[model samples]
Every structure is written in C-alpha cells, then in structure tokens.
Target chain A: MKLPADVVSKKNGKHTIQPLSDPKIEAKDLDFFYSEKKALSDVTITIPSNRVTGLIGPSGCGKSTFLRCLNRMNDIIPGTRVQGKILLDGQDIYAPDMDVVQLRCRVGMVFQKSNPFPKSIYDNVAYGLRVNGWKDRREIEAKVEQSLRHAAIWEEVKDRLKSSALDLSGGQQQRLCIARALAIQPEVLLMDEPASALDPIATARIEDLIQELKKDYTIVIVTHNMQQAARVSDFTAFFYLGQIIEFDRTEVIFTNPRQQRTEDYVTGRFG
Target chain B: MRLLPKSFKANKRERGIELFLLFCASVSILTTLGIVAVLLFETVDFFREVSIVSFFTDTEWTPLFAQKRFGIWPLLIGTILISGIAMLVALPAGLLSSLYLSEYAPDRVRRVVKPVLEILAGIPTVVYGYFALLFVTPLLQKFLPGLSGFNALSPGIVMGIMILPLVSSLSEDAMQAVPRSLREGAYALGSTNLQVSFRIVIPAAFSGITASFILAVSRAIGETMIVAIAAGQQPRLTANPLVPIETMTAYIVQVSMGDTPVGTLEYKTIFVVGMMLFLSTLVLNVLSQRLRARFREVYR
Candidate 1:
C-alpha cells in the first residue's frame, strides 16, 4: 500500500537522475546477434540506483535479451554474440577480467515463470546463501525471513517453510522467487515478464512489491503488459525491433510519447 | 447444416470405420489381457506341483539327469549376480556418456556421436555374445586366471554395453525435458555449471532418469542369448563372477533347446523359472513407475 520515496522523477520525455542518484549501471551501444539474426542493435541506456525501470515491447522485440545482457545470461545461449560496452558502477562489466559469478551475484534475476527449486521452501530460500558460504543457521534463517517479508510473502508461507515449494500457488511461488533473489542481497534485480503467468490480483501484488522494493534495490523488468509498466516502473524504455525507440519516465511514455511507434504501442494499436 | 446425401453417406461411413477400429483396438487389448491370464495360470499350475518353499529355499536346480536337485536359489542367485554386475558396469558409464552428449558435447560432435551410440543399441545380442566369448573372454583371461570359457563376467559386461544406449538415450530425453528456465535460475543465482547439472538438472529430471536406470536394469535382466552363449547354463550357487552361472532366462533357453524331455518336471521348470523372472521384473517395473510419478514435475 506504501510506495517507496526513491522513485525517479520525470521531465518532458526524459528522466534526469539526480547527482546523488548517479546511475548504478550504464549501457553504451550494446549490440547483440543470435547467429546471423540481429537481436539488439546500437542500444544505450542508464539505470539509476534504487529505482525500478521497465522495458516494454512487443514480441520478438529483444527486451528479454537486453535484460539477459545485464547479467550475461545470453552467454549460455548458443550462437549468441554481443558487441558493446556495459558498465556497472563506472567499471566496464564486459572487461576481460570480469568475473561472471560475482557479476551474477551483484545482479540477480527472476524469470517469467516462477522456478522455485524442487526443494522445501526453507531449502529454496537458503540455497543462494548456503552456496555463497553462509554457515550460520540463525543468520541464514533470519535473512530468509527478512527477504520473504520484503517480497510480501512472509505472511502466506511462514507456517510452511519446510513444505515443498512446488506446493505453493503460482503467485506465492513468484513472490518466493523474488524472496530468493533478495536473499542474495543483489544490488540490482532483472525480472523478465515476472508476472506474465499470474492472474490480475497476483500481478497487482507483484506491482506493489516492486514499488516497495525500489527503495533498496535497482530493478529492471521486461513486460508486454502496458498497464503493469505504468503502474510499477518509475522509468520505462520502449523497444521495437531490437532498438530502444523511446526512453523516458513511465508516465510520459504511457500518457504522451514523442515517437508515433511508442504512442501506438502504449495505446494498444499494435505491438 | 444441410444433410446432402453424398456428404451424409461419407459421414456415416466414417463413423462405421471408427467404430470398427475401436472394436479392433478392444480386441487387441483383450488379447494382451488373455496372454497375461494364460501366463499367470500356467505359472500357478507349475507352482502347485512344487511347493513355494522348495522353489525359493533349496540350493540345487538339476531338474533333469536323474539326480534332480530341484532348488531355485542357484538360478536366482545366478540371475541377480549377473544383473547386478551388468547394472554396476552400465549405470555410471551410460549416465556420464549421456551427460557428455547433452551438456558437454559440441553440436557437430553430438550430431556424430549420438547415432554411433544408437548403433550400439541396435547390435543384436547374439553378435554381442560371440564378441564377448571370442574376444572379451580372451581379453579377460590375461588378468583373471582359470576363468571359465563360459563365464558370467564377460557376458554381463557385454550386456551392460548393450544396454548403455537404453540408459543414455532415455536419460538424455529426461535431462533435455528440463526447461532452460530451471538451469538459468540456478546460473542466475551464481551456481557453477557443475552445480547446475549435479544439483538442479539431475534432480529436476530425477524421475525420468530413475525410470531410465530401472528400464536398463530390466533390459539387463531379460537378456537371454548373450548369457545363453557366452555364459554357460551351469546353475551354480556361488556368487563368484569367474565361474559359469546360469541366469533364469539362460536356464529357460537351455530347456527350450529340446534338451529337457516334454511333459517332465524338467520341462515344467522353465515355466516356473519364467514366472519368477516375470514376477520379479514386474515388481521392479512397478517400483520404477511409482518413483517416476513421485518425482514428477510440480513447478509447471
């Protein structure tokens, strides 16, 4: 019910990150290819710290690819090649010496479909922490509970931490995924259609959680749902044909856009 | 919807054909049920003549040649020993090969390697038997002294190789069935590739993989000609692999070759042994199905 105070403010069709709100991540001319087929071309963007940004686009528009590029998820995909310079906190993330494991830890991801490990809820939440060498049981349990409370799922699953995560409803499962990501204490969260598989009520709950989480974490999301973007994100980037057509404050992108393509898409004329 | 006579006749004929097909399907289903019924009835009859106690407890199994030491344990021990050895050789080698194919192999190499593996599956057990007897047994003799020419070790190893495809192919299917999202989830959480495969992917596909292993076990158990030729038809009670031991199926093979007289208990022993093999495998198969269902995907 309460939105965080850290949401970035808007002007005309652009978002100006305050000097104190210096961007945590910046992409400069990021280009991607899947074999011969181009996915993203000459795309550049900045993500301000402690704010939620949403990437809105039609199918095949490469929003998910861009999100994956943030954490090098695209590296696992075969025939995927990228040419670009991406920086995290002023350091080039694509540098030869970059450690992907540490990069992934600094930048966590939740997928469109909730993928809780086929483990107990307690084990699922403890997975990331234990893998990272968190040996103290009391500390791990506290962190997991803190994360679940942050994701707005503590009340629902508190009584059943030892139950199989697969027993949870889809909405609860997605929230649990968010909790799992938070347990890692990632500086940024990349969500790819995180609520596309959920019902309206679940979607709304996720949107509220995103709004609440903006105070502590920088979040990037890709969504086909126009209303979700406007509701959850402070800034929105409209991508079309592997290019960011418009990057601006979410209200401006939805209510009034500079590009006719962005306008038509937000107005629901076509993808 | 106008009921044109020509179209009406076509629709009526289609319905008639569908009904006839259903009847044929039902008849085939009844035939299967009938075979099971007959097999069970004959096995029960064979057991009626021999007490279940002697059939399981006694050590000797000389159904013919007048001495008639009619114990079933030698046959069972032989079957278990060979099958156990075959599974031991097959399970890890097959699973690791599949892991290489699915996870580690380059695309071009996989394209070449998979079919080569399938060729192993297609080779007849008889050819494998000859290869084991003539080739592998000679190879084994260098290390194991006084190894019987017809021994369980060579045949079991060859049968294990023969069933590798069964394990690898089925495991590959199950492993591939695991969605990319699951692996990505693990990776996104900073787990290594080894961690992903061992911790998540394997567990995610646990049901399918376990079923595959079970199927390979069943295949190793039922394999006859390989053991019949390479493994002698000596029903030994010892657990040693260097000596000749006859599996239940190999004993059945010996009886079917017309060495045992018709209508004698020597002949009836085949049915009894067959029933034991069938029932044991049936129980194994049921356990596999239950494990398969227990670990079935619930995330979706």
Candidate 2:
C-alpha cells in the first residue's frame, strides 16, 4: 500500500524507508484536548516503521499528550477529547471500527520514570503475555527470556528470574520495562522521556538500547534534553506550545532550522 | 545570668502555663504507664492461680458460679471464630472495593460510594448489635439451618460489614500510595486496569496492605457489643458459627452482668482475658508497623 510520507521524517538525519517498505502509523491533523484546554492543535505527524523518531520540547508542550494519543492512552483521563485521524498500518485508527485492545498490542509505550512491577523479574515480563492469552508455562518462560534478551537485559537477569524487578539497578529496571513492552512484540514503541529518570550512566545505556532496538521496531521518544535527542534519534520533531514548530533530520533542525522560533528555542533564547 | 535572660523574660505567666502543660503531658504518659502496670500486676496474679495450659485449653468458661470451670478455650475459640468470619468476609470485598474506588470508579461515583461505605463506620457498635439481633438473624435463618436467634453468624457478619470501611479506606490509601508513575508504566505496556492494579499496584503497596489488614483484624477482635447482643454467651469450643458462642469480651460482659466479687478469681478472669486480647493486638500492631517501616518507599 502507498503510505503518506511520514511528515515527521522530513527533518535532517531522518532515515530511509523501512526494509519492509510500509509505514506503521500515521496521524493527520491530530488534535487533543483535556476538557476545554487543547493540548495538541492540528498536529500531523507520522511514525515510520523500524526507525527512532524523537519529539523534543519543554514541559506541557503536548509532546507527551501527542504520544499518548498514538495508543489511545489519553482516553482514561477524564474530559480528554481527541479529534482527527490516527492510522496504524494504512488503516484509519480513529475511524470507529478500531479495536483499542488490538491497537495497544500492536503499539506499546514506556514512561519517564522506570516502573518495574514489584514482583519477580520473570513475572513482570510474563504479565503482558498472560493478558494476551498465552497460557502455557513453558511458552511464558521462553517468551520472557526472549523479550529480556531483545531488551539486552537477559544475561544480567537470567540467573535471577525470581528476584523482584524492583531489586534491579535503575538502568536495569528501565530495560526491564522495555523488555516487558517487547514481550508483546509491538510494531511501534512510544517512550515519554524514558531516560530522564536515570543517572547519566543509566541514561547512556538506555540511549544505546533505543538505538539498537530501532532496527526491529519503530521508536517514538519524547525528551527535553536536546543533546540526547540529537544523539539517539534518526529524525527529530521540535514541538512548542502544542505545535510542531519545525521537524526535519536532526542535523538540519539543529544547524539550519527553517522556522525562527525553532532556532530561538534551540539556542535557549526563550522556551 | 545571660542564659536565664532569654526570650521569656517578660512572660512569667506564659512560662507558668508552659510548665503546667508539660506537667499535664507527663501525667498523661504516666497514667498510661500506670494503667499498663496495674493490668500487668493483676494479670500475673491471675496466672499464678490459673495454669497457662488451663487458660489456653480449658473448654468451659464459667468462673463465678459454684460449678466454675476456668478452661479459657471456649472464649478463645469463640473470639477466633468470629474474627475469622469477619476477615473471611472483609478481605476480598474490602480489597476489591478499594481497587474499584481507586482505579475504576468515576469521581462522581467515588464521592457517593466512599461516603456510603464510610457511613458503615459511623453507626455505633450498639446499633450494629441491635441490627444484628433484630434483622440479620432473621434473614440468615432462611438459608442457614439451626441458626439460633443469637448465633455467631449474625454477629460475625455484622462485624464484617462494620469493618468494611476500615479495610476499604486503608487499602485504598495503600493502593493510592503505590505511585501513579507505576500505574502509568503498567498501562504503557498495554495492561488492563485490573492487571495494573492487582499485579503492579497491589504488590508494590503490599506492606501498607498488610498493615491495613492487621488493623482490620484487630478491630474485629476488639469489637464487643455486636457479639454480646447477637452471639449468645454460650462459650462453646466449636467452630459451628451457626450456633451461639461466647467470645472473650462477651464472657467478661457475662461475668460483669452480675457482681462477681472484685479480686476473686472470677473478677480476675476479666483482667487475664483482657491481657490476652491486649497482647494479641499489640503483637499484630507491632508487626504491621515494622512491615510498613521496612517496605515503605522514601520518595525524595
């Protein structure tokens, strides 16, 4: 199927088509609201298959709200109203025929703070599988191991499957969250400042993990740290006050922004 | 001279009031200590008269009468049976109610449901006893066989209902304390509301839940009027709750019904039984406190 150009990827250092050649998700004129206040305004963006795209802005610029709109996570918030179109795999997701449960399975998310369940590491990863109806003990174990391996946390946690996930180091716990998401094998992974909760070293590990994971899954990350975004993302979208002021390859957006507001914000003149 | 010439130089009357308040505070603490000391002394005295084995294992509980048998098992078993029933009914319903309040119920529904449940707590135990005797016993008799007018089932069920607010309120606080970030994390992974609550939030808040549970159980044990009025003072050692049984508090009330001469072994039984109840709750309270201390996250 011919896919609309992922407008978010028009920025520099923006990578090429997926080896599979199909866009996983597309959003057209997407608007989001929390009661009377609009959090996202006419923002159209696309999440390409198997690439790391970063959304950067200051607090409440609607980056997180937009990310939430991708998987319908904002629906739980009282008075949250969303409009326009969100598509997954050339199918219009907002078209009333969508199944939210299947949409969530196909697209997963991680958060700013590392939230490893208080149970054993094995159970934490095993949770999503069980909910999706995986019943066999052997299959659950193998899947947990496989997911942890994909998140690059398997070797460290292999000997301690029964140990509480909370007992792991902060970096490891963040990776465990990734593994838990990976356990469901989603097509798109949305991360909202997944590294902000970590120390520098831990942040570096997560950055590396994100870079590696993009080869197999699409990644959309929201970060306030411009350097981290420039370093890790293949493409970057700079959002300001509920608008995508500029979006392009990371190099172009940094060295040669098309919009003046994007340059001033990039240079720390005004947020 | 310099040390004495501090800020209160012009406030002698205030100083006197401060000293008086300090004295009152000390007196309150001392009064508590004095009461504990008295209970301890009398309890030890009673233990000397009644062997520990007899206190724990005796099946009959009459002490003031000529046929006085001091085996405390009847009262102990009765207390356990009622508390057991209370916990059995309270735990699941209370936890689920808390989960719904925290996770599922809408704000408007929560405002209504929460107060409705807490209203259970506001009604006096005596009122609960009356309701148990007058209403619950009759209702239970339709389905349950041999459920006497003052069977343990009515009182225990009423006590369980009475403690619902305690369990729901506390467990809700515990679940709330599990951190919204943890819940957000669970949801980002595509977890359902129940999955996020039961798997992540509940276990993360386990210590608080444990503390809440122990507190509920203690409340159930210490409850008296309902059992006294609804569960007759039979003092049986059986778990057949459909029949009447006399709990320890009810036994104390039974002895106190008429003048059991003070300082007699009969009057002293009150103190001994009181000590046992006190000690049991004390241990559970301490355990709950320690569990909360060890597991509570210090969020900076």
Q: Which residue runs of candidate 2 sit more than 4 Å off their true CA positions?
A: A1-22, A95-97, B1-22, B298-300
lDDT of 2 by residue, B1-300 (tens): 676666557478788989999999999899978878887998999989888787667778778669878887888889999999988888888998999999999888999999999998999999999999999999988988688887888899889999989999988988887777777767766678878777777877788888888888988888899999999988888989899899988877888887878888888888888887888888888988887776665332
Specify the CAPRI tier of model 2. medium
Please, what are the lDDT tens digits per residue for candidate 2 over residues A19-134?
42456677888888888998899887766677788898888899999998888888778788988898888888777888777888988998777887777899889988887889
Candidate 2 chain B has its poorest 10 consecutive residues by lDDT at: B291-300
Interface RMSD per candidate (angstroms): 1.0, 1.6
| A1-271: candidate 1 lDDT, tens digit per residue | 1112234465688865444357888889999999999999999888878878999999999999999999999988878898988999998878989999889999999999999998899888898887777999999999999999999999999999999998899999999999999999999999999999999999999999998888889999999888889888878999999999988878778888888999999999997
Kindly report which residue stretches of model 1 are placed more than 4 angstroms away from their true locations once superposed. Answer: A1-17, A251-257, A267-270, B1-49, B290-300
Model 1's lDDT to the true fold?
0.87
Colliding residue pairs in candidate 2: A11-A248, A11-A249, A12-A248, A12-A249, A12-A250, A13-A249, B58-B71
The best candidate by DockQ is 1
User: Which pairs of residues collide in candidate 1?
Assistant: B60-B71
